[model samples]
Target: MSNPQEPYQPVQPAAWPAEPAGQPGNPGQHGAPPLPGNPPHGAPGQYGAPGQYSSDGPFGLPGQEPPVRNRRKPWTILGVVVGVLLLAAVGVLILVNVVNGATNHARGLADGFTKLVIAGDSSKAYDDYLDPALHEQLTKEEFIAGIKTLKMDRTCKPAYNQVNASTENGTKAADVAGLITCDGDKKIDLAYRFEGTDELRMINIKLKPQA
Candidate 1:
């Protein structure tokens, strides 16, 4: 109060050497920077030991290794291989059943046609099972005459033993080959070829007599 008239001289604040650890002289800063794998000062939780880090969270906190997960087991790989093999076996079994069914049906057709001609019922055999192509080439009388030339126009029975099915021109076909046992122990080794469609018809015929 006594120096009020002496002069209006004001005292200045003291300057720091390096701004302490962290404060304003910087942008949006507060205290000192924390050590690695540790939160900043004033955060909860105790500090870790030297060169040690927390591994409580996923993939660790920041400086820790991730968890160890084992690879696939041997039993798991074996199960997959067994499953594939079972499926393939089932497919092969189904295929075999279908082929056997087709072959049996084709054998039935062959049995009917051959028995009819051998039993001297040539007209019915030719009209029912012979193809239109054969009809155009030969009359029904000629067809019967052809059977008679084989000495098969007699009362007889058929013993067709084998048949196989296949595909031809996008249609089902079959071949029936077997022995035809007639009356008096006469055996004719014969094969019949039939082509596919909505109906069964003979495409070719072969016969050999066994004396």
Candidate 2:
């Protein structure tokens, strides 16, 4: 007699096909093109690799170099220094010219005053050029008498030479030396003081024989 239940069959597993050599699915193939920005195999050196330098500079990556500082700073400093020196020179020149002008004017006044005294024009000298303060203290007769005491020859002319000029406390003073042709060329030193700007006033005069 046969059994009524049917017999059970064993299930077989599915078999997958093996990938072809050098294909996209191959596992052992390593000669494929490198990915973007990746260095190829056996290349000279990789970017940012040890013991390698870029074309720009050592220790820096390609297309990067150390920063360059301002190159014009030194030139600019030199220019400024030169400009200041020029201005200082110009200022000195101008000061020299002003001092020289003042000295020349003072010399001229000294010569004129000496001529008046030698000419015995005491009244004109006192009225025109004498410092107001000095005129108040000295009478015209006394001035004339004092000039006469010099015993200068009235017929001979006098020559004046500028010695030096100086400034103190805003007052300009000049020293003038004179030689009288008569009386054996008597040499006299005169000190003249001036005050005011541009318009200088003869403040005082001091005369002495050269030792």
RMSD of each: 10.4, 7.0
Query: lDDT tens digits, residues 1-211, model 1?
Result: 5545666688988876777543556444655455578776434343345465455423546535556666567778999999999999999999999899888889988988888878778899988888888788878898788788779745555676778898767788999988877677788888998886777688787767876
What stretches of model 2 exceed 4 Å from their correct place? 1-33, 41-63, 153-185, 196-199, 208-211
Clashing pairs in 1: none
Candidates in order have lDDT scores of 0.77, 0.68
- Model 2 lDDT-worst window of ten: 56-65
The sequence of per-residue lDDT tens digits that candidate 2 reaches over residues 141-188 is 887787777766576465665456777786666666655555665655
Model 1 poorest 10 in a row by lDDT: 41-50
What TM-score, to 2 decimals, does candidate 1 have?
A: 0.60
TM-score of every prediction relative to native: 0.60, 0.62
Best by lDDT: 1
